[model samples]
Target chain A: MNRIDKKEAKHLLKQMMQIRQFEDAIMDLMARNIAEGGSHLYAGEEACAVGAMAAIRPDDYITSTHRGHGHAIAKGGSLPELMAEILGKETGVCKGKGGSLHLADVSKGNLGANGIVGGSIGIAAGAGLSIQLRGTDQIVLCFFGDGATNTGLFHESLNMAGKWKLPVVFICENNLYGMSVSVERACAIKDLTKKAVPYNMPAECCNGMDVLAVKDMVTKYAAKARTGEGPALIVCDTYRYYGHSRSDPRVYRTKEEEKSWRDRDCIITFGRKMQEQNILTEKEVTDLEKEVTAELEAAIDFAIKSPDPKPEELYKDVYFESPSS
Target chain B: MREITYRQALNEALSEEMERDQRVFLMGEDIAVYGGAYGVTLNLMQKFGEERVRDTAISEAAIIGAGLGAAITGMRPVVEIMYIDFMGICLEQIGNQVAKIRYMFGGKTTVPLVIRTEGGAGRTLGAHHSQSLESWFLHVPGLKVVMPATPADAKGLLKSAIREDNPILFIEHKMLYNVKGPVPEGEYLLPIGKAEVKRPGKDATVIAYSRMLYFALEAAKRLAEEGIEVEVIDPRTLLPLDMETISESVRKTHRAIIVEEGTKTGGTGAEIGMQIIENCFDYLDAPVLRIAGADVPMPKSAVLEKLAIPDAERIYREIKTLVS
Candidate 1:
């Protein structure tokens, strides 16, 4: 854990900033009626995404959830295409058919983000099964929310991966709440790793606010997964700074709770830590923030200039036409 | 050509496809060591090994989602959901994930997977196991629905559904598994949406599929003796209903009767009948008559089950009246 070089920390910091700024811009666009939809923002949970993503190779697959922009960016998705996809432009990754909730970049090994709560859990298991069948060392990192842990698929997928020893690392981003339903109300235990115990899979919990802690935990399980040791679950203790979606006012949460989590913000803490450690200076952190904002602005401008899909595009892609058919 | 049971024909199709392509594999509950609940996948695991022939837990949603995941990743997975009635457990996986992945991905991926499950009530298996639910998949736009009535179709259409890039819901009837029919010797594939004229006649056209096709054919034979020739058409694929062959036969005969084993309310007959009105309304014969199961849950009682489903006599009587 102490071996994380200054360059590595900076790269992780940059990725986290990119995700934070992207969500910030999406909220701005929603306020302005430009990007016309609800977006599940990944603002406070930046360390969880950045750290887990840092442990895998570029070719390794990751199945994402509704709040997936952080995963997409951390997996090295192009900003212009992602922004255009959110804006529903033809130049987007899914040709504008998949808006913010359904972004996918197969070429980058992001299987896709799903709208269904536990939709991508089994998909991750399948991807891991594919990897094992193909005799490859690749692993599939599955991201799901706390509410999805209560679904049947979560248990099924874990048992499958545990029994078959499929190469998957299931990451549960237990952000304390699932659309106003507290994790305590939904799940029997506060520690989400308890769900993994029944499947005979190794389970661990990490401080999601700390990038190094998440990276270390994911790196440990990912190594075991790559070596054909089967799947493991890592429950990250994090919090969402914003409401679940655009329409939510978050009346279920208290202002004290919000301020408490915001006080330990990943970006602020990571930046200050690096500055104190001489990895980066105060001026350097400010410059990084300025660079992220400028890049986000350009992405917005590009999305605005991109062409909307034609009306005929509605009929396309309903079914894949094969040569034999 | 040699005669084989519908079950053997399906086994041949799966075996040939697994032999032909390295990427194709099979997964379901008890399909590997147990040879499936209905025995259609017998000896496949022994032939293909446990790697290709995967036996899953009683997890319907995971099986379907895994099939979709594998298919999107360039592997051909034929996922069996055991029975069509069990489709309700994983309908979200079917309707939300498996069917919609390719379209939602905007043609960037090709999902080639088949969900093979048996339907129809002949054995008194009660309400849950014996119901025919192929019509449920027909409503999902991104899915291709197929039900093969004959052994020849069982082999050919299964091959075609495996090769087709779209996600297909291949519904087989439990009653038709033992039905024998002649099959071709070598590898052959049938078009997914072509309807075959099983027995050609001119007085009235009968559009039927799966188990209902046999009843209609028997009724046609009885009607032929009564000087009323009933043309029987088997619409093997429901999603892409072969309207070309159906409408053509309707135009020729000027009368149409739809036969299905599913209950009457929201059955396949309603859609096919409405399409007949939409397409061949000007042909001017009569309103499309449908002989379908009674609109109620399949009862465990043998007599009640017999009374609920339409039989050869009911088809004969219905077609005779329509022709008159």
Candidate 2:
């Protein structure tokens, strides 16, 4: 893997901060009853999505999970469209039909945020197979939580990808609990990566709070997959800052445990590192924060001003242009 | 012109489509070396090789999901789910994903995938193996469901389904696989969503599809012997149903008898009956009659299974009742 430079490190830190702030604002909106529907906040797990995306090219594809705002942001989905989508506005991605659970930008190769657990695993494998058949060097990054590992589709897709040497990197953000059930209680194998070994694929575990560590591991595995070395699994052991969704108060874990993980927050840890290296001053970081906050505020305003989709428009787009229409 | 089995006609359609379009491929369990559960894809592996005529794992969800992914990314995938009953495993991917992708994506994406599966009872495969779930798919808004009753239709309709831009659920009756009929040698296409009047008459119309169409034809022959002329109609495509052809026949005949092999309650026959009543009620001389399978799970016993499903005798009795 190549060494990360000062400029690249700063950019990574900014992305992590952006995700943290965005999720915080979403939690606040949900609390105030302003944002309709629910949201799966990706606060503590930002490092995994940011680092993995940073390792891949813009053309590489990714299949996201229901907890997907971070992945969408990291994959370059516009913040305004994402905000509008959460608000169920017509101008949003998927024309607001998908809402928070299903956000897709196929043009950028973000397959879609899946609502079904482990549903996108096979889809990602198929995309990788397509890339292999087309003779393109593009790799597909399949993202899922610990809960998805138990699904039959996950094992089936992994086995096929292993046998066919499909270009894909399976990134498991093991956030300890799959909704309310802990991975230890649900899984027979405590080490999540060990599950990959049965399929004859190499596996590794990384401290997901450290973006640089995740970036380094993903870069190596993604390169191997691109060169037809077969699929690899990277288990990023992390924690979610908030409950599973807006409804969960997170009675599953101790408050002390949550605070301990929060102490090693990815955003603060990376920001402190930048300061120590003299790469960024406190004033510059504050300025970046201000800019990001204003940008998100404007995005909310855009979503509010966007007109609702017309009722007659509902019948349109049901089929690929009906024979007569 | 040539004569071929319905299974062979379907195989030729698949082989021709694969040869004509590089993006077209076939995937199913044992479909590669073993040819297929019913031998419809026999010798295709030798022609297209493993990469194109691929055999899949027993994961129905993965099979359909792979087809959905491949179709969206510029490929025409024909997936086989050996039995229609097995569709329950992949219903989410098929119903929620493949069927809704085009509409949900606002028509930006096209899923040109065909889910080929066999339905109906005859070989005593029983309960799970012998069920007609075409009505379940027909109820869905975005899916196009097709069932061919003859060799010519098996070839032409399958070709049309392969050329379609939406997800098509192509159903085949397990009993009709070996039935022989005339099929043109050259390339031919059948317009989907159109009904063909197999045997025209002016007394009463018998609407049927798949294996039931054969029963309807047999009933028509018996009715003709008694001098009570009957019109036999096959609405080959269930979703984009050919109401125009069916209503025209009902108008001329002044009565209708819908035949189906599925359970009578809420079956495809019910849908056809409702459509005829809604569209051609004023033209009908008698109330629409439906001759369908008994409202019970198909039995494993050969005698009980035969008694459960609709046959030629049942069709004849229903048509006689409607006309008398």
Candidate 3:
């Protein structure tokens, strides 16, 4: 059964709310020119990030993609630092060096967002190798887009993770498109799970809009991987509410498709499901939204008032201090 | 003192470093059972077992990417690319991720990764197999470039590089793997950014590294016989270049010449010679000359290959011209 206690379920709802609100606020900032840098919004894909992260332990690893604010939020990243980072402030998680596309909260097991397509796949394999060699049960949840599966790194890393049986889960956030090009135009076959066939990895496709379904499907694999059953690849059939970036006009998709996806907004549906199950009251769900709003408002205030990285910090942090450099 | 081949010296360094640090490991294509392309990692798998001395698939990006991943996660990984020419295939991982991660992360993490690869043309491997790609990594800020000319330096510098907290591109010459040189027994480590005056003299200062270091020494020996004495200084560590040593030598000799096996266009010699002009310009009696390889790819013909790279005769001739 796709079940969890009311507290954990409400926790998932809160994280989803944080991601949605944060992404929406970023769009507002970009419109007003408050945040000058580019941002890949993750508004509609909240369930996939929250549900998959809900299955893993806090100490476990996660390698995120360019659109990674949702993953960081679900992985226990501080909203203040995340906001500070996106605003290019010194108090940010990466000390302001990594902006939107490179936000990393390594202290919380978030390995940062990658700017390049398919960049984090191989790194996920390496982290898995680290766990395997060190005899740890920590599994790395690697996230990438449908477009990344076509890259050579995707093939090489998957073959490696399968051959070595490194404990990892290759999560495909298949929102049906790679930027302007739909997956139908880019991929030869529409079924994305078939890409894992040659690697001999156990694969599945789940309704990414449902947090319970995503959590149930991924929890099984995460448990199996911990028991030394090797790796698995999964597809989360989700959608991004915004364009590839802030400036992308999103002329590729039809309004009907957009409305259909928004009709099943993850937060609204999941909150309704919780209410029907008697897991929480409607008043409780409203309370969570109120808490999230206060949190995001505090994060915004902290980000706006924070100072920029000093000009002389340029030469710093190139290399960490070791015995020899 | 024990005389060993450069290949043997590198193997010893790997074995000792893995023995000393449990966090240290090796990963690459054909580096385990097949014993590395140049045999530098021979017998390491037997000594460290399959887990520590990992044999990877023929995926350059994964090999390097995995190394970076392991490094930032508190493990020390020494990964290998068979040929320096092949580094171009995975330059994104090396340049963008491994090199820039520490700086990009604001020093919150350390990437203790060492990339071992071989370059230079000698066996007529053509353009694809042999290339001096050290200058490419040198251009990346977060990377350290090391080229050890002798077997002793190779063993010592590889140890230092393995212990280094940053990404290091350790370039070896395919031609120098078999060359024998004296190496201290047991364990010894040389500092990464220091230069040594191989042969001191009064006429000119020849700055070289890798195989070019030997060419400069050969030229210095012959020029010594002609009373046109030349000093040879090897800048073993390329990134934190021992410019102080080179400038001090140039101040004494009043002449500087850079010999490199890579091409003259945008080569290491150009960078080093320009630095000499900028740092020690007033001390120079004449313009600093760079004796680099011909501006062409490594060809199939041995004669053409020989004519392309710098030799002792060419170094000696270039020095004679600069001094007179």
- Taken over the whole model, the C-alpha lDDT of each candidate is 0.91, 0.87, 0.90
Span of ten consecutive residues with least summed lDDT in model 1 chain A: A316-325
**TM-scores of all candidate predictions against the true structure:** 0.98, 0.96, 0.98
Per-prediction DockQ: 0.73, 0.51, 0.70
Candidate 3 structure, TM-score to reference: 0.98
Tens digit per residue, CA lDDT, model 2, A52-123: 999999999999998989998899988888888887788887777777888888878888888888888888
Q: Which ten residues in a row have the lowest lDDT in candidate 1 chain B?
A: B65-74
> Superposing every Cα of model 1 onto the true structure, what RMSD results?
1.2
Candidate 1 regions exceeding 4 Å error are none
The alpha-carbon deviation from the true structure for residue A286 of candidate 2, after best TM-score superposition, in angstroms, is 2.2
True contacts kept of each: 0.70, 0.42, 0.68
Provide the lowest-lDDT 10-residue window in model 3 chain B.
B129-138
Where does model 3 exceed 4 Å of error? none
Better of 1 and 2 by DockQ: 1
Chain B TM-score list for all models? 0.99, 0.99, 0.99
Q: How far in Å is the alpha carbon of A260 misplaced in model 3?
A: 0.8
Per-residue lDDT tens digits for candidate 3, residues A166-194, read 88999999999999999999999999899
Docking quality (DockQ) of candidate 2: 0.51
